[model samples]
Structure formats: C-alpha cells, structure tokens
Target chain A: SQTIHQWPATLVQPVGSPLSLECTVEGTSNPNLYWYRQAAGRGLQLLFYSVGIGQISSEVPQNLSASRPQDRQFILSSKKLLLSDSGFYLCAWGGTSGIYEQYFGPGTRLTVT
Target chain B: AQSVTQLDSHVSVSEGTPVLLRCNYSSSYSPSLFWYVQHPNKGLQLLLKYTSAATLVKGINGFEAEFKKSETSFHLTKPSAHMSDAAEYFCVVSDRGGGGADGLTFGKGTHLIIQP
Candidate 1:
C-alpha cells in the first residue's frame, strides 16, 4: 500500500517569516507530486507540481515555491510569508502511469499572524 | 480548460435519508471526474472517480456517482446519510490526457450538514 506524509501538521508564523513544508511518499517511486492550497473561498488551487527530481511546474504565480529533492520527497517553501499565504496546504501523489488518480496527505495548516 | 461546479454550497439532510451532492463539469474532450471529501482542517480524500470506464462508479464509504456525459454532471449519492458524513465535499475535473502533472481543478466545495 502507498501512503503519503506531510509536516509540520500545524504551524503559526509571523508575517514576513520563512515557510517550509515537507511531503514524502512511501511504497512508491518516481511518483508525481503536487501542492495545493485550500482557502475559505478560493477552493483548492494548484500551486506546484513535479514530474521528477529537480522539475517543478508552477500552476499560479504566488509567494510559494516547490522542489523535488528526491524521488519520494517534495518540499514547499517561501522566503517570506504573507497574511494571504495562510491556508490548508495539501500534498498529493499520483502514479507514473496513464490514469490520473491522486492520493492526498494529512495536510499542513499555516496561520500567519 | 477544465472546470467543476458544485451546485450547492451547503446541503442539509437528516440521518438515514438519501444523500445528494450535485456537481457539473466542463471540458473540451473526454474528462476525468472525481469526488473528494474534506474533514474540517484535513486534506481532501477521494470518494470516487469517473474515468470513462463505468457510467456508475462506486466508491469508498458507501458513496457512488453516475457520470452523465450529455449533462456533464457527476452527482454523488449515498443510500443513507450518517452523522459522520458531515463535511465539505469538492468536485474535481482533470484533462484526460494530462495525467496528474497537469493538476486538477477543484470546485468551491459543498458543506454537507447532517441533521440528527
């Protein structure tokens, strides 16, 4: 069975502070990883996706960035946090095959005060 | 471009009653549709998906959805609603050819309220 993990589960950051969220998948290799943010009214917005190591695609321009350091490890980072950057961030992984199904992690909640 | 619309922002249903969460999608070609549930402050968990193989797809937690191509709707249903079913539901659409690298478009989400 495949499982995804993300942390820190929750965080409180001051405005203009740095942000880092990590995601990893076990029992799978070369998985496609994605980052999504869910806000009150914005819904789930795709922030970044990775097809392989060192390859990241930005879906929307924002304060965040993503990196795939290893085949199963993905990181979402920001140099400075904004009030608008606070939301529930999710990490997902999908197989490298044709079907487009995705599995999500527990998520991280960042509260920028 | 692909998009999804969850018809109701909130739905209230009594326990043991039928559950209906409406969703419609727009895609230029054949699309892959999915239904995901989010518990408060948690990640989205997929309930079911339609990938062109089955018109009626059965998913986890006793939930099922029927794909209507003519209407471009994938509505989720359950025979009986449970208190545990109270959560936010999202409808998603994906381009059939892009795989997961293209990402998914999510609906605004419907807040399902289970009445006692």
Candidate 2:
C-alpha cells in the first residue's frame, strides 16, 4: 500500500513571511504529484502538478510555486506569503497510467495572519 | 474544457432516510467522474468513480453513485443517512485528454447535513 505524508500539519505565519510545505510518498516511484488549495468554503483549486522530477505545471497563477526535488518528494513554497494564501493545502499522488484516481494526504492548514 | 456542477449547495436529510446529492458534468471526451467526501478540516476521501465501467458504482461506507451519460449526470446516493455522513461532498471531472498530469475540476461542493 502507498502512503502520502505531509509535514507541518498546521502553521501560522505573518504576511510577507516565507512558506514551505513538504509532501513525500512512500511505496510508489515516479508517481504524479499535485498541490491543491481549499479556501474557507470553496472547493479545491489545483495549484500545481508534476509528472516527473524537476517538471511542474502551474494550473493557475498564484503566490506560490511547486518543485519536485525527488521522484517521491514534492514541495510547495512561497518566498513571501499573503493573507490570501491562508487555506488548507493538500498533496496528492496518482499513477502514471490510465485515468488513475488520486490519493490525498492529510493536508496542511495554513493561516496567514 | 471540463466542468462539474453540484446541484445543491446544502442538503439536509433525516437519519435513516435516503440520501441524494446531484451532480452534472460536461466534457469533450469520455469523462471520468468522481465523488469525494470531506470531513471538517480533513482531506477529501474518494467515494467512487465512473470511467465508462458500470453505470452504478459502489463506494466506501455503503455510498453509491450512478453515471447517466445521456444526462451527463453522476448523482451520489446512500440507502440510509448516517450522522457520520454529515460532511461536504464534491463532484469532480478529469480532463478528457487523459494523464495524471491534468488536474481535475472540482465542484463547489454540497454540504450534507444529517439530522437526528
């Protein structure tokens, strides 16, 4: 079975502060990774997705960016956080073949005060 | 472009009653649809998916959804509503071009309220 792990379950930062959230998947190699944000009461919005290491596609223009440092490790980062950046961030992994279903991590709650 | 629409923003159902959450989608190709549940402050859990397989897909917790291609609808239902079922439900549609690289489009969500 594969498991996805996210670090810093919850965090509170001030505007203009830097942000870093890490996601790692175990039991799977070369999986597709994705970063999604869910606002207070809105549905999830895809921020970024990576098909392989060092390859990332941004779904929407935002204050954050993503990087796939390793085959199973993905990181979402921001040089400076904004109040609007506060939300629940989720990491997901999917298989490379077919219309594979995505598995989501526990998620990180970010509050930018 | 693919999109999903959850018909109800919020639905209230008494416990022991049938549960229904409506969803409709639009896609250029054979669409892959999914239903996910989200507890308060928790990540989304896959309920079921329709990928040109069986029209009726069964999922976790006795929940099921039927894919109606003619109507472009995928409505989720449960025989009996449980208090634990009180959560937000989402309808998602994957890109027709295929591949995990394409992100899914999610519905705003329907808040399911199970009343005792």
Candidate 3:
C-alpha cells in the first residue's frame, strides 16, 4: 500500500535557472530515499540517497543536490541548472528493515533549454 | 564493487513468441539481483528480484528470471511476448550485506520490441 508521489510531472527550465523537484511517500515511515537521473537513451544514474532526515550521500558529482527535509519528503534542487541537468528524475523508497526492494515514484521530466 | 551487464541492447520478437533478455553481474559477495521495466516517460517498475533464496523467480506480467551463480548470470524469460511488453528492461545489482545503503547499479538496458 505504499506509494510515492513526485512533481511537477514535466518542466521546462531555462539554462542557469534555479530548479526544484519534490518527492513524498505515504504509508511508510523512516524509509530510505534515493534520487536517480536518466539521460536520453542512457541508463539510470544514481545521484543521491538518504537513510534519514538531514543525511544525504552523493554517488556521482554533478550539478544537482538532494535533501531529505522530512521522514518521507525528499527534494532535489540546484542553484543554477545546466543543459546537462535535463533528464528524467526518479525518486525511490525502501524499507528500513532487511527488505531491499525499492518502490519508485512517477518521476519528473525536466527539459533545460 | 557491484555491476550489471545486459547482453543485448535490442531484442525483437513476434507476438506469442518466447522472450529472453540476458544479464550478467559481478559482485564481491552474495548479491541481490533485480529486473526492472520502464515504459516510455514512466518510472522504472521492479519486475523481479533474486536474493539467494531461489534461483528461479517469478514476477509480474508472467515474466520470470533464473539466477545461475556459476555463470554469474540472471536471464529474464517469458513464455509469450505481448505487445504491451514493448519497453526498456534494465538489469540491476546490489550488495547484500552492506546495510543496503549502496544504491543499485544498473545495466544499460535492453529494448524489447514486440513485432506484430
């Protein structure tokens, strides 16, 4: 019964503009959250993950950053966006226990022009 | 370090034909493997996962995968291919004992094309 919500479903941003994408989960608490990006015709790339509030781990250095402001709320932000920052961003959550299966949100498609 | 390799970038099959997508993985320890599907413009959906409990795992939409430890491969199969099955498939691997903090490593993906 757990579900994740991400928005805005699609966005068009100008280069060098600020960016913010939000993801929230329901029916679970203290779950681990992750941020991933998929470029056109490329595989999913891990950007950041958080085990708890105020804790974030970066996998690959890029123009994006992630934050877990609440137990079930994760936000991906950038002070200034780059053309390379445009991609399909996904949010996922996994249980705190030994359960390793991750549930994904609908995702946000950003187009930086 | 754990990594996954999808042997094929594109696979075409006729409707009702058997479907197979090949995957291979490398891990230092016992690893957890998964297959995920992504529809165009949609998020990735987990189809199946292998955690060392069973070599053969069944997933949604009549899809199944077998884990061959000796070969270090987990290949996904289906009895019949459907038009709805046309999408991109990704093979993923994760370390089993590292507190599960390490995010999944994904394959480049295989594009499954269902021919009419």
Candidate 4:
C-alpha cells in the first residue's frame, strides 16, 4: 500500500520569515503531486502541482512555490511569509495514468504571526 | 472549465436520520466528480466519486452519492447520520483529460451538524 507523509504537523512562523514544508510518498514512483491551501472558512485552493521531477505547475499566483526534487519527494517553500499565507497546507498524490482520485496527507498547519 | 456548487452551507440532522448534501456542477464535457469530508483541522477524506461509471457510488462509513447527469448533480447521502459525520463536506469537479497535473475545483463546503 502507498502512504504519504508530511511535516512538521504544525508550524508557527513570523512575518517575512522563510517557510518550508515537505511531503514524501512511499511505495509509489513517478506519482503526480499537488499542493493545496485551505484558508479559514473557505474551501481548498490548489497552489501547485507537479507531474515529474523538476516540473512544477502553479495553479494560482501567490507567495509560495513548489519543487519536486525526487520522484517521491515534493517541497513547498516561500522566501518570505505573509500573514495571508497562513492556512492548512495539504499534499496529495495521484496516479500518473488517467484521471484518478487523489490521496491526501495528514497536512501541515501554518500560523503566521 | 469546471465548477462545483454545494447547495447548503450548514445542515443539521438528528442522529439516525437520513443525510443528503446537495451538489451541482458545470463542465464542458463529461467530468469526474467527488465528495470529500473534512474533520476539524484535518485533511479532506474522499467519501465517494463518480467517474463516468456507476450512477450510484458507495463509499466508506455508510456514505454514498448518486450521479445525476441529467441534472448535472452529484449529491451525497447517508442512511444514518453519526455524530462523527458532523463535519464539512466538499464537492469537487475535475475535467482534465488525464493525469493529476490538472487541479480540481472545490465547492465552498457544507457543514454537517448532527443533533443528539
């Protein structure tokens, strides 16, 4: 069975600080990875997605970026965080084949103060 | 382009009562739809999905959803509501031909409340 892992489970960052959230999937290779943000009282918004290593697609323009360093490792990063950047960050993976359902990780809660 | 709309923001139902969360979607062509549940501060868990297959899809935890293409609707239902079912439900639409590189559009969500 395949499983996804993300950390740190929770994070507190100061304004203008750097941000880094990691996501890794085990038992799968060349899977599609995605990053989404769920703001308070709002639905989730897709931030970025990657089909393969070194290939990242941005769904929306924001203060963050994504990178797939390895076939199973994806990272979400920001040079400087903003108050609006605070939200629940989720990492998801799907098969490279046809349109399939995605599986989400436990998620990271980031609070920018 | 594709979009999803959840009819209710909050729904309250007594325990053991039937659960129905309405959802409507718009797509250029045949699209994939899904229902996901989110607990407080947790990630979304897929409840059911409709991907050009069975009209009625059964999911985990006694939850199911029916795909009504005529009405452009994919409504989620439950035979009996449980206290644990009191969480936010989301309707999602995906029209990408293939691969997860395409992002999914999510509904604002319906907050299901269970009355003891």
Candidate 5:
C-alpha cells in the first residue's frame, strides 16, 4: 500500500518568516507529486507539481515554491511568508501512467500571524 | 480547458435520508471526473472517479456517483445519510490530454450537513 507523510502537521509563524514543508511517499517510485493549498471553506488550489527530480511546474505565481529533491520527496518552501499564505497545505501522488486519481498526504495547517 | 461546477453550495438532510450532490462539468474531450470529501481540519479523500468505463461508479463509505454524458453531469448519491457523512464535498475534473499533467480543476465544493 502507498502512503504519504507530511509534517509538521501544524505550524504558527510570524509574518515574513521563512517556511518549509516536506512530503514523502512510500511504496511507490517515480510517481508524480503535487502541492495544493486550501483556505477555510474554499476549494483546493494547485500550487505546484513535479514529474521527476528537479522538475517542477508551478500553477500559480505566489510567495511559495516547490522542489522534488528525490524521487519520492517533495518540499514546499517560502523565503518569506505572507499573511495570505496561511492555509492548509496538501501533498499528493499519482501514478505515472496518466492516472488522475491522486492519493493525498495528511496535510499541514499553517497559520501566519 | 476543463472545469467543474457543484450545483449546491450547501445541502442539509436528515439522518437516514437520501443524499444527493449535483455536479456539472465542461471538457473539450473525454474527461475524468472525481468526487472528494474533506472533513474539518483534514486532507481531501477521494470518494469516487469516473473514467468513461462505467457511468455508475461506487466508492468508499457507501457512496456512488452517476456520470451522465448528455447532461455533462456527475451527481453523487447515497441511500442513507449518516452523521459521519457531514463534510465538504468537491467535484473535480481532469483533462485526458497532455498525459494527465494538466492537473485537476476543483469546484468550490458543497457542504453536506446531516441533521439529527
């Protein structure tokens, strides 16, 4: 069975602070990875997706960036966080065979004050 | 371009009553559709998906959705609503082209409220 892990589960940060969120998947290799953000009572917004190591496609231009350092490891980073960056971040993985069904990680809730 | 529209923003139903959440979609080609549920403070969980093979797709937790191509709609339904079923539901659509790299377009979501 495939599983995704994300941390730190929840975080509270002051404005203009650096941010880093990590996601790792087990039981699968070469899977596509994605990063999504959801505001309270809002739909999920795609931020970035990676097809392979060092390959990332960003959907929205914002204060966040994503990196695929390894085959199953994806990291979301921000040099400086904005108040608008407060939201729930999700990591997802899908098979390389063009499957649209994605498996999501536990997610991280970030609160910027 | 592909998009999804959830017809209802909020739906309230008494426990044990039938549940229905309507969704409409637009796509240039044959599209893949999905339903996902998100409980408060949790990640999204895929409920069901339609890939053109079967019009009626059954998912976890006794949830099912029918794909109507003529209507361009895929509506989720359940025989009985449970208290645990109260959550936010999102309707999603993905393009079949570009090797699935187009990602998914999500609807605003429908909040399902289970009344006791």
Candidate 6:
C-alpha cells in the first residue's frame, strides 16, 4: 500500500514571509505529483504538477512555485507569501498507466496574516 | 478545453432520503470524469470515476454516479442518504492528454447538507 505524507499540518505566517510545504509518497516510484489550492468553499485550483524529477508544469502564475527534488519528494515554495495565499494546500499522487484515481495527502492549512 | 459544471451549489436532504447531485461536462476528447468528497478540514477523497468503462460507476460509502454521454452529464446519486454523507462534493474532469497524473478541472462543488 502507498501512503502520502505532508508536514506542518497547519501553519500561521505573516505576509511577506517565506513558505515551504513538503509532500512525499512512499511505496511508489516515478509517480505523478500535483499541488492544488482550495479556498474556503470553492473548488480546487491547480498550481503545479510534476511528472518526473526536475520537471514541473505550473498551471496558474502566482507567487508560489513547485519543485520535484526527488522522485517522491515534491516541495511547494514561495520566497514571499501574500495574504491571498492563505488557503488549504493539497498534494496528490497518481499512477502512470491508465488514470482512474488519485491519492491525496492530508494537506497543509496555511494562513497568511 | 474541458470544463465541468455542478448544477447545484447546495442540496439539503433528510437522512434516509435519496441523494442526487447533478453534474455536466464539456470535453474535446474522450474525457474522464470523477467525483470527490471533501469533509470539513479533510483532504479530498475519490468517490468514483468514469472512464468509458461501466456507465454507472459505484464508489465508496455506497455512492454511485452515472455517465451520460448523450447529455454530457455525470450525476452522482445514492439510494439512501446517511448523516455521514454530509459534505462538499466536487465534479471533476481530467485531461487525458495529461497522462495518468496530469490535470483535472473541478466544479465549484455542491454542498450536501443532511437534515437530522
């Protein structure tokens, strides 16, 4: 069985501070990773996705960026956080064959004050 | 371009009643559809997916959705609504071009409220 883990379950930061959220998947190799943001009561907004190491595609342009430093390690980072960046950040992973389902991590709730 | 629309923003149903949440999609290619449930303060969970397999896709927790290509709709339904079923449901469309782990477009979401 595969398991996804995320750190700093919740965080409170002042605006203009740096932000770093980590996601990792165990028991799977070369999996597809994604980062998404969900507002209070809205759908998910895709931020970035990684197909392989050092390869990332960003969907919406913003202050945040994502990196696949390792096969199973995906990090979402920002040099400076904005008030608008306050939301629930989620990480997901999927297989490479046929797409049917995606497994998600617990998620990081970041509040930029 | 592919997009999804969830017809309802909020649906209230009494426990033990039937549940129906409507969803319609627009896709260029043979699209894949999915239903996800998000509980408060919890990550999104995959309820079910439709990929040209069975038109009726059964998911966890006794949830199921029907894919109607003629209507371009994938409506989720449950014969009986449970109190635990109260949550936010999202209709999602995936980009087949994104491979298995590509991109998914989500609807605004329908909040399922259960009346005791």
DockQ of each: 0.76, 0.71, 0.72, 0.75, 0.72, 0.67
lDDT tens string, model 2, B1-116? 78899999999999999999999999887888899999998888999988888999999999999999899999999999999999999999886564446648889999999999
lDDT of 2 by residue, A66-104 (tens): 999899999999999999999999999985667467889
- lDDT tens readout by residue for model 6, A1-113: 88999988999999999999999999888999999999786788889999999999988999999999999999999999999999999999985676546788989999999
Q: Between the candidate structures 2 and 6, which one is better when assessed by TM-score?
A: 2
Q: Per-candidate TM vs. native?
A: 0.96, 0.96, 0.97, 0.96, 0.97, 0.96
Off by over 4 Å in 5: B98-100
What Cα-based lDDT does every candidate model obtain?
A: 0.90, 0.91, 0.92, 0.91, 0.92, 0.90
Q: Could you tell me the interface RMSD of model 6? A: 1.6
Candidate 1 — which residues are off by over 4 angstroms?
A: B98-100
Write model 3 residue lDDT over A1-113, tens digit each, in one string.
88999999999999999999999999988999999999999998888999999999999997788999899999999999999999999999984677677889999999999
The recovered share of true contacts, given per candidate in order, is 0.76, 0.59, 0.59, 0.68, 0.59, 0.59
- Tens-place lDDT per residue, model 5, A1-113, is 88899999999999999999999999988999999999886888899999899999999999899999899999999999999999999999985676788889989999999
lDDT of 2: 0.91
- Writing each residue's lDDT as its tens digit, candidate 5 over B57-89 gives 999999999999999999999999999999999
The global Cα lDDT (0 to 1) of model 1 is 0.90
What are the per-residue Cα lDDT tens digits for candidate 1 across B1-116? 78888999999999999999999999877888899999998888999988889899999999999999989999999999999999999998888564347657788999999999
Candidate 5 lDDT at A20 equals 97
Candidate 1 pairs with clashing backbones: none
- Model 6 residue A80 lDDT? 98
- With candidate 4 superimposed using the best TM-score fit, by how many Å does residue A108's alpha carbon deviate from the native? 0.5
Tell me the lDDT of model 4 at B37.
92
DockQ, Cα level, model 3: 0.72
lDDT of 3 at B89: 98
Question: Which stretches of candidate 3 lie above 4 Å from their native place?
Answer: none
